[model samples]
Target: MRRLAVLGGVSIALVAAAACAVSEDVSSPPHEEPEQSIPDADVREVAVGSDAPAPTRGLLCSSDGWCETLLPDPDLVVRDIWPFSDRAFAIAESFTSGIKVLEWTSTDSTWRYIDDNSQNEALAELAVGIWAPSADEVYYAVSPGTIYRGTRPVAPATAWSWSSERLPDNNPANVNHGDATQRRLTLGVWGTGSDDVYAWYSNTIFHRKSEGGGAPAWVPELIADDFDAPDEHIFITGAAGKSPNDVWFAGSRRRGTKEPCDVLVRKTPEGYRRIADGVVPELYSDPCTAREGIPQVVGGPRAWPRKFQSLDGERFFALKSWNNFLRIEPDGDGYSVNIANVPKTLLDAPNLISLWGESEDRLWLGSTFFNSNRGVVVRGSQVWGDGGVYEYSSIALNGAPSNGPPNQIRGTSNTNLWAVGDRYALHKTTP
Candidate 1:
């Protein structure tokens, strides 16, 4: 669910930080590069990808910012932002036929190829994220349920030939893991020599002991039928809570009118149990009211890998709001909910409230309003980015916070945190 850079009047803020070495000026060589056709060399067209273009109708962004239009291809959709090392921009770009990774370096923002593996014409492995069971290499999931991957440092994906590798189930075109399409699989990523993976795609609300696998397993045991995630549109929004035992999976359920939607959360223990729904207002065109298009769940996405608020034993609370915020507390049987409206102290703020997290004591909230998707600054009842009660001190920032804005954030250790999603991924430590 990537927001394609479209034709918009985007506000371009040239943060003269160290990253802009990404500009073509620094990446391109003396004479080997192609002539710049567009005015803004900052924005580059994805030569090969499956991501669909946004509206042909552009927006009036600020002066100079990054934006692009959605193409006519129906299969095209930006899958996920590739993880980064020290000097590379790794990206997962999809195609109607297959998937590929467009890799580039800071020295040259020109994206090259990472993996051009064997393809299955019958089974177009629409690759998603790269998981590391260990550090030796990385593997890309063709999709969530099916786990086909390549070792790290994926190459230009052009060599793939369909009908090559065989699966244990013998199903080449594996899309859904089991008989259940209702279940969205989430990987319990682990590491050995490389990143190993586990899954949760069960028939009933997934119970902890269930088993699943493709490359990563998708247990059908995790989702309960009573949980109420729409059959078709329902998807895993994120796993909220603090620990594995306390984890809660977030699901988006579409109901009644096509556009109007609701968010669902089911506790992931003993099996799935209903926790709450529609914590945030969903966009709906009443049955009688004429609607223009679908109202999107802005900032609503399954917390990217390492993006959820979970530690070994604690599950962080989850919240979302446009004008207000929603928080939940587990009751003996059900759950108690609290609603907080974004105070004026932070309403007119630059970024919109997307996520909030708290440690044992300090509470932190983050926003990415408009296109200013900056790092989540620790804020209280105040605007983030502009200035917040909590500025990241060098000690707090000792963790290599993604040099770029975290499309998603997750904290594992008191001092170790990980953020993924956006073009640049983050692995930071808080001293």
Candidate 2:
């Protein structure tokens, strides 16, 4: 059930290859000792990661080079994606047809089926996550909790402004682990619009605020009050920021020896701190805490951190434990992590699921290797002398023989990318 994917626009090609060096010594004197600012040439590139080699077969590509499989029923499985501004929204499944929510705007580039009420099968088996923040604000998340808020239709025979409520289970109890008990999973949804939204159940942190500006409500944000104890259990996997007080939330805290460290936090206006705790001890060792390796999965989130932030939230990243990428920054009164390097290591998989871009030199990475069912699509580059590094170059989009396992990836640039899993869906457009 590891499907997750998001936003849109186009034209993105940021390849920063800076090499500047200016020095003046006109004999020497102005204070006499000032000449040691040399730090360049580090074009960051150490990624043949997870051992990239064979690929280029029929060359699967989207973004116009033609890579189509938008469901003509190849057994359907394009779980999540939410591009904007030419519109896109996806969540599809098919065992005999069950979960569906599809759309493509700007007058249909192809892909339809969007009938609401979350297709109700008890809220499509407690929805889980899908966020859109624009193109008429969309959101859906249901579980032993809820939150639905659509608003599309402005034409094409208009009429869609649904809404549902109930969300505040403040850790509604679950976590025993002697014989097992941790099922409360619902772990995503970000914000920056629709009155600053946010949602995260399982380490609780809900908040919405549109106020005198009107409509947008969901509360339960008392962030980090000792973040749950009695043997630990914090879980918030991913969040971004721009407002709602400059945010950032990436998770992991499990302990009681069920092990699962690394949990970074940061939310301002003076609340919630702790930038790095376990900071990723290779994700608590033993190749993701022993037991045949990775998949400590209980109710939700056993996925090792997948993140990316920078839209005025001031840079932060974490592809951690699929073989490290952690970045963090802004150190002067707090924060500084850095641990890059993600290249070749598939069968040794440790989960590096999804991450998007718009910055960090046009980032985007998505991985999955459930023991060689394989999946990868890395293309990140952020190189600038000492203290500015991140370089990855991967391929092997599971579609080797033909498609599946990209999990989720979104784009608004970097050639307007988009990726899906299992039954396939791809679109890269150009560059």
Candidate 3:
């Protein structure tokens, strides 16, 4: 096991902002775009299907639509992949081998094991999140309040060196009726650069900043008790921002199974503030505890916004309940919220899961249905400006398997796109 470095403290204040709402009725006709067809020669499956020794489950596509799968070990299950221009990094876990970090380069076209978590069971089994600011630097977050940093090796070294840091454990044993273990689990890690990284677990957010002429250290940015009621718990699922001053973190707040509310908080030049609060009907059957309502759709367990992404910092998109999608833009002092539902005329009962885009008018949403073999990718184009409606169309996956759904959609541009999930990876080179 690696020795853990204790972190220092920093004090930050939270400010409550006035809730603002600008609702738009999206009853207009659904906008549609013509789908492109890829030639048989342009698409191919590498190490997928039942015949391969270890099926490729994780994939990364370069800026030019060149795709590769990450499968260094047969028993690994990849949780996340982060890509750079020429190299990529992934986090995978195995019951027998523990946690593994794999690296791939465009030149080699093969995945290589680059991490050293094999001896530490806790680090191996619990590392779930990864983010690379550059090919030389990366950050991995282990659940239960631990983080690891890896830097590229110099000429004499053959491997990367990793250092560990420990965060303040807010989840002491037996708290919240012994369910505090869930709160200790880190959700993810993200940043604009190497110096401005952020990580959030269940309810707490930590920031990594440099001290007086020494290495950067993680410090508590926000804690649950400072923001929520004694009975309420906040589960941060996703985060994104235009820059350090305009970042946003979102998730759901629950006070038992009966009440689940949507949470949207932002960090500006001033400090952290709660900007929006609404209800998540899919998580609870009882009445909503709506304080200031953001748009929501009524449906099953997948109703809440699971992930958030933005091409530019001014506007953001998130996957919502069923076929519905969320669009958030900067409004006067708050944000303008719009919930766009997939037209029933296009598809029936599609559960949108992943989102990626190149601009406000050009977006791709990935959908997978319950008890179904195939999934669909929907393209959304803005029909107007903020609070306006979006036109959506279905994109066909030519070589992807029937049983696979695009769990994640990412690309450098519309001309070079990739959708990967469920043992399959699909790439599109045409706009």
For candidate 1, the 10 contiguous residues with the lowest summed lDDT are 14-23
Give the winner by TM-score: 3
Tens digits of per-residue lDDT for model 3 on 329-357? 76444445555655655656777766776
For candidate 3, what is the TM-score? 0.71
Give the better candidate number (2 or 3) by TM-score: 3
Who wins the lDDT comparison?
A: 3
Model 1 C-alpha lDDT per residue in residues 66-167, reported as the tens digit of each score:
112222233323333333442232334334434555443334323444444333332433343444433234444443233433444236733322111211
What do the candidate models score in CA lDDT, each in turn?
Answer: 0.33, 0.52, 0.56
Q: Give the alpha carbon lDDT tens digit for every residue of 312-424 in model 2.
A: 68777656556445455554433444444344442256356666665765556666555555665665566212333343333434335335346677778766667777776
For candidate 3, the 10 contiguous residues with the lowest summed lDDT are 1-10
Better of 1 and 3 by TM-score: 3
Candidate 1 yields a Cα-based lDDT of: 0.33
